[model samples]
Target: MSLSFTSPNKTIFIYDSTKTSEVALLQHVKDQTSKLTEVPINITSVTPQLLNSILTRMEPGTSSLLINKTSPWYRCFCEDFSEMNDFILKKTFVKFPSLIQTPIVIHQDEVYVNPSMKHIFDIYEEIYV
Candidate 1:
């Protein structure tokens, strides 16, 4: 499962809508992008294909980037799974989409997981300025 960006100039925002913080982040993204006249932004929910694409962009042993470590499901998953590999992580994410950390911003082939406000602003600057 991989993602091929048809337009390298576009930005993709992947987030879980159910999460309030993620929702806010989505809105923030919208607000920021609204200032740009031509930069295309694709906002989407966290789906299996998107998750796979995110995981592929991540560095090895960085599964934490994709997971909400504070979630109860994460705690239980940690206890049940002896290892934290891509397969297990993907299964876990698929089973509990809520457990996936979101507000992932993909721009210019760079993936930002749970990026801060500063990072978001920086991304916009990089794109529009």
Candidate 2:
């Protein structure tokens, strides 16, 4: 049997699929965090190629983007709202729209996140420390 070592560090690209503040805050957080210490999070463009690369690199320990609260991404940005929703739903990277509205936790092939902050902390503590 191969002795497996887990890589807790991961590249979390806060991809901005649309042109909005969501991109900025995520980018800002990443930038500020960069100055302090190594952050597992990274902000990047959410275009087709970038998103694909992000998923490709995902592994054991990973953190998804915690989009800024006011980000217009929760709803369709373009005039074609219905079509946009359909497109987002169809994509493998964004299959679950629920994750967009609410924070989601995925680990070991599982997805979970509670609405409360403390509960979220518990989950993070279990994963990181």
Candidate 3:
């Protein structure tokens, strides 16, 4: 028999197909959290408004780091917006959500962009303890 657990708080997972590494990271987060914590994660496709909201919560320069420079989508974005000021870059994400990196994890008011295992643990502790 198998045992399962669920979280009381809503966990929003935003992912994109362009980021292969993020996909694996997202899976690892789910598995680790399932085993170590009671946080139930819900995976969802990202939206433009959602991207805008996440960026709004972050510092100007910090949010831009979430852009996946190696992805083909980024190549085109760089070509088009060669010199992206903070405002323009944030606006662009609101227009084209796919241009940003994934998988973003949003737990309540906190948001994690391209989360690591350490990041997941930190958030879990913040919420649970």
> Largest TM-score belongs to which candidate?
1
TM value for model 3: 0.58
Please report, in order, the local distance difference test score of every candidate based on alpha carbons: 0.63, 0.34, 0.58
After superposition, candidate 3 runs with Cα above 4 Å error:
1-8, 17-20, 32-47, 79-87, 94-98, 126-129
Candidate that beats the other on lDDT, 1 or 3, i.e. the better one: 1
Spell out the clash pairs found in candidate 1.
none
2 or 3: which has the higher TM-score? 3
C-alpha RMSD in Å of predicted model 2 compared with the true structure:
9.7
Query: Model 3, residue 15: what's the lDDT?
Result: 66
Can you give the lDDT of residue 1 in candidate 3?
7
C-alpha positional error of residue 52 in candidate 3 after TM-score superposition, expressed in Å: 2.4
Tell me which residue pairs clash in candidate 2: 105-112
Whole-model lDDT, model 1 = 0.63
- lDDT accuracy of residue 119 in candidate 1: 80
Candidate 3 lDDT tens digits, 13-50: 66664456756666766665543222121233344444
How does candidate 3 score on lDDT? 0.58
Candidate order by TM-score, decreasing, is 1, 3, 2
